[model samples]
Target: MLKNLKLTTSIIMLSSLLVLVAGCGSKKANDSKKEISVALNSELSSVDVSLAMDNTSSDVMEQVGEGLYDFTAKGGVKPALSTNKPKATDHGKKYVFNLRKDAKWSNGKPVTAKDFVYSWRRTVDPKTKSPQSYYFDGVKNYQAIANGKKAPSSLGIKANGKYKLEVTLDRAMPYFPSILAVSASFPLYQPYVEKQGKKYGTDAEHTLYNGAFTLKGWNGSNGEWSYVKNKDYWNAKHVQLDKVNVKVYKTEQTMVQQYQAKKIQFTQISGSTVKNLKKDQDLTVRKIPGNQYLVFNVKENKLFANQKVRQALAMAVDSNKLTKHVLQDQSLPATGYVPYGFNNSKTGKDFAKQAGQLVQNNKTKAQKLWAEGLKELGMTSAEFSILSSNTETAKQVDEYLQSQFETTFKNLKVRVAAVPFNSRLSKQNSGDFDTVLSGWTPVYADPTDFLNLLMTNNNNNNGKWSNSEYDQLIKDANDKYALDEQKRWDNMEAANKIAVEQAPIAPLFYISQVYLKDPNLKGMMLGPLGQPYYKDASYK
Candidate 1:
């Protein structure tokens, strides 16, 4: 989700190496007549929309499940399962939707408005413990249900009949429709979900599909999967490819080898690999709105609780050098928490530019801060490890930070704790990390999408860093000044500044993903967040 419209902040556990290319030799022999193969850097963990915390699962969900609204290529919102744009009433606090009668799940069951209501309730149900529960904070009673103060059935969404749905919000959110466009907001067939129970979404057979394609060959832990055209989908006629095969290749060199051998049509490459492929006609360089940041475990790790320590670590690494030398791609050094050009002022100035630079590389300042922090903790030296995904890019990036921190702070010892993408997310969620390299892909385009995550007791605030003023500023942006565009901008700008200045989470960079795709592979929509959708893709 990276379009100007409803962007969802689904956690990207690992940045995927998305690549597509025309193949020759053995790769061509195994594929179906109208199929293409691509690559993923990590495992496809889950298909359950409510439980999908990673971008890979979210990407798959977008193709297998239909949401009420979908993002248009021109950054507008368009109806997906719904018949037309939702009719807003009650001062934009309520919405009415009419469903398409022709839509059907892969199992041949008719899709009804009830599916939306059930899906929403399931996400906010405390028992479900969905990672996406916080995404519905704007829905009436959603917060109470998520907090266990109310039942999920009390959530303010209802099926008026077989084909009509109505939703009420706690307050008017102009971007609520954008939320509806995300995979987290997709409908689920309640009967099938209940029938499979714990086994639902564990594999292709256990999951239901209602979008452009149905997932196949995935057995939950497998490294390979396929997206086959969904004949039951209402808009199947526009879906071109018969199938899109995806396989996981952990190393950049291996991915490049696969691309060179024509075994995979798409693959992500970086560093020297990108330089070598820069002249390729099918190479694509895309700058995304997502951000990679360092999350400090301030609650459990007292070392990070000291503002000076956090600041020291944040400042030690030269982001400019890291992006230019270590990353070796189009990734930009982060100026602040929000990425550049992500949001614009009423007059069209970018939010990141308006906030100005709050973080900088200062070896002297970092040294001073480290000394002061050590003295504050009554210690001469300290040791900590950085947690990161084991993906090729993450390993290289974390290795660089480890060297920078150790070299800059002579008294401090730093270690790199590299784990699989799923393990990293689990550790981050359980606060089982010292400091983790975390990434966020906005579910929507607004700054609140990122700022909201750091607020006091926010579900996604794995670091447990809290500030009352920061919380108030974000609240004012979404509540007090929501109706006033200029005032809302002011609140968000203030909040962003506070987050960076505090250094509880050190903003890193915005990814400029480089990949290869065959010139004949057309119709793929690379969303604003840099994840490509292959439903409309076809081989020429």
Candidate 2:
């Protein structure tokens, strides 16, 4: 979530890369016991930890960088560069993270508290324009520094000594330690970042690794890259895979073909192809905490501005059909903005179960609402386009939505604009299209991460949808209702209900990562955030 925030895709570049993958399906054949081959759905967007925000970029950063803490595949936090979990004081607002004395960067520089302090300040700097900066909202003076009201140096974080870092927050953050594991909060190598200047993280050579692996031979332009074991990493002895070669295969068919030929040890398959692949014992399904939804530009499209019309559009789409037939991955249909697995802190019952299905298919009722909405707007017909990314799954979903919207509403002319993922994000940010088919991988496991987007003028609210009462509900969920578990969930449930009935955005499905891997591959654990943690991974 540049604070939902990451920053885009080049159309020509992706198309060219797809062609390259098709021609070189059997390329990069040098796999060994110390190494493995893998595939990425998208290229690394950027290498700069402070600037990296997309899921792909974040994944790459996970290999090459380490935060104070590292997230585990089993939904636990592990010590990484930090010697231990942060010591909290002031009722959880003040945290002091101690760095490991032996933790060293790839370049042999000791990892220090100063590096983290510099990285945090750099991200919050208004001039950096890092989208991830908004995640620092509650930190002391973050708003002031981010809004240019104060100097970056005055931000809450400070280094007590070379290895000790002290951070002050404005309020209690129950998941602050987990947030530290996110790539945006990772430490930066000051001398390297400063010397390389704007070119830092543009290539592997510019950035130094402190984690289990170091990005090697990545020129910042190629879709193919690799991560090799970093000899200087503190925990290098336990990292069994000496190297991981990552290739970006644009089409699912090509990716499957490559996987079948033993060229790609890991690759994603289209939902329609899953049945045939199930015979192969290595096929696996990993459900993730990500949501794919439709964001409507109420400000740009007068038709969408009518609450009734938005509700009609939402009701017409059957998420079950899309998930079962189209997705075919055992992916759960989304009930609310939040996914199904997360428990309500108060009840321990599933949050989605509590919220229930907000929008359901009601053809007769939806048609009536459509007619009434059109009449209310004093219009006989309206035309709008749905924007989406250029991916196999995205294409299928876009087609499904286009068919549903056009067939459901007699007077509506619907179109779809599919571009590369990064380009799709650019269009959404500029408010270029009507309803955009976009998704958010959770930055952290919290209802607030999803609910906060609906707040009026929130950075991730690309649709410009606003509701004063809804905003207050979310505000209370984060503030007055925070400490009280029951009240906080109540506030979240209330706010999400309002958003759903209003239909600013429509929930589609929670993502389930369906892929084919070599049977020999073991310990390749995919974490809750929808990324694989390769640190503990090794051959069976």
Candidate 3:
């Protein structure tokens, strides 16, 4: 076994932490190798894509589920389960997909086109209460089904034959192919899902794999899990790794210790430990196409209901200092909700730079706004607590924000509710908190993915921010401007401006995926959405 490797400074990466040392030739993969172990910051709860919106679930889904398309290293779309790209017709509103004949479920049943139809319909079904169903908005009748005006079966997706699938959209979409690459659009075999009932996706046994890996040894609560290669995979001959193992370790110290002890190949490190990593040759810092922000529950908190209060709080955030000192990574201070890396469809310049700064440090203006907001509400004092994940890095950022707010406004009592990641998501979704730190990554490469969430009644809009003008702008961007590339791009930028001005969510910083990877690992392509594809990855 090629166990020991000394890291040099010749590593390469793009948006996420996938590195390969320069001048190292590829080596033949040894299929008899044991599972490759890595660290996960949070626990893996579900492989059901509809119910699980978090990153860990998405990671697990990629191992077990195969989508119509997958992403390439150049931020481009590529075919996965389908033989190639879908054929577009009806002015790009209709897409026909041809599945590979060899694709089969872990149970030895052929993976048919109808599996995609059933899985998509199940996601948009009102009974499922899927938080991620909003991803289907532009699909034909998807919004109607989600809004309870149409039946789930009415969703405009059908299997044309045993191997061909047809998808009808409400309008022509330029980024539809990219959207299909996300985990939310993947298929699930119908019979197994029905047999397992609600317990499906809760553990390894209940779920079946159709992708490159078959998950095993996870009982839904264990901190350790493994992804064994699927022998029945259609392209199993190309899958280089025999198995990949994951262990949940929240402490940065433990991850570092594990890596140094040669027990793992990669781990994410943050805080002061970043200083230590700069000297280590294995360090590779990469930006993820996402932004961290704070969402407020306007319906529950009267103070937060006032736009002036929200704006005041937003302007007072000093993200530049936070990213520089606290995060200590190469993360940038976010100018708006949309990430900085996305290119404008018209000008080809950066989207975030073109949109400009939505909110910034202006203590005097913030103070004036706060006073006006308090007077409008006829109150002198107000208090609110922030809900945040309990990870070490999250704790540092949350503590910084709490101290800043409490010190800035004497009348405002700011508290931090640090809970486990799953608990935090539950609390935020139920509208049980005054404020919470959250984030969103683009499902595709389009700016609309981040901008559309603030539209009226969007599923992820837990803040209950309703603005008719903002909603109209988003509608025009996704609907009216669908055909004109420049017009749609302009509308998306305008919508993000409205979201920033209203301050329902305060943009903080663009999150970076920091990795300490072994130099020998090759062919791991980290997609624009922060997912790593290891289909062709192998040790050199």
Q: Tens-digit lDDT track for model 3 on 1-540? A: 000011010011133321111111112122224346665787776788678677777767767778888766766666788887855799878988899999988988999999999999999998987877888888999888978899988998999999999999998776677668767888888989999999988888988889899988899888677778898888899998887777777788877876766666667777677777888998877766678899988888998999999998998889998889888877788888887766754566777888888768787888889989999999998888889888888889898888778777778889889888778878888888899988876666667777777877787888888999888888997889787767777787788888888898989888777767766667766655445565667765
Worst 10 residues of 3 by lDDT: 1-10
1-540: candidate 1 lDDT, tens digit per residue: 434433222222112333222222345523554777876776776889888767777777777887888766645567888887865799878999999999999989999989999999998988887878888988999868877799999999999999999999987877787778777888899999999999998899899999888998898787777789999989888887887777777777877776767676776677667777788887877666678899999999999999999999899988998888888887889999987655453556777877888878899999999999999999999999899888877888898898999999988898899988778878988899999998786766677888999988577899999999999888888777777777888888888888888998988887767887766667776654445667767777
lDDT of each: 0.79, 0.75, 0.76
lDDT by residue (tens digit), candidate 2, 1-540? 111111010000000011112112345433466677777766666889877876778778878888887766545567777777755699768988778899899989899999999999999888887868877877899867866789999988999999888999977766566677788899998888899999888888878778889998789768778889999998888889988888776687887777777776677665787766777787876665667889999988888899999999889989999999997877778787876555654457766778887767887889999999999999998889889877777889999998998898888898888887667766877788889987776665567777877778566788999999998887776767656777888888888789888999988988766777777767876554555667777755
TM-scores for all predictions: 0.94, 0.91, 0.92
**Candidate 1 vs candidate 3: which has greater lDDT?**
1
Q: In terms of TM-score, which candidate is strongest? A: 1
lDDT ranking from best candidate downward: 1, 3, 2
Clashes of each: 14, 11, 0
Show where candidate 1 strays beyond 4 Å: 2-26, 29-33
After superposition, the stretches of candidate 3 with alpha carbons farther than 4 Å from their true spots are 1-34
Model 3 / residue 526 / CA error / Å: 1.9
Q: For each candidate in turn, give its C-alpha RMSD to the true structure in angstroms.
A: 3.0, 5.7, 6.1
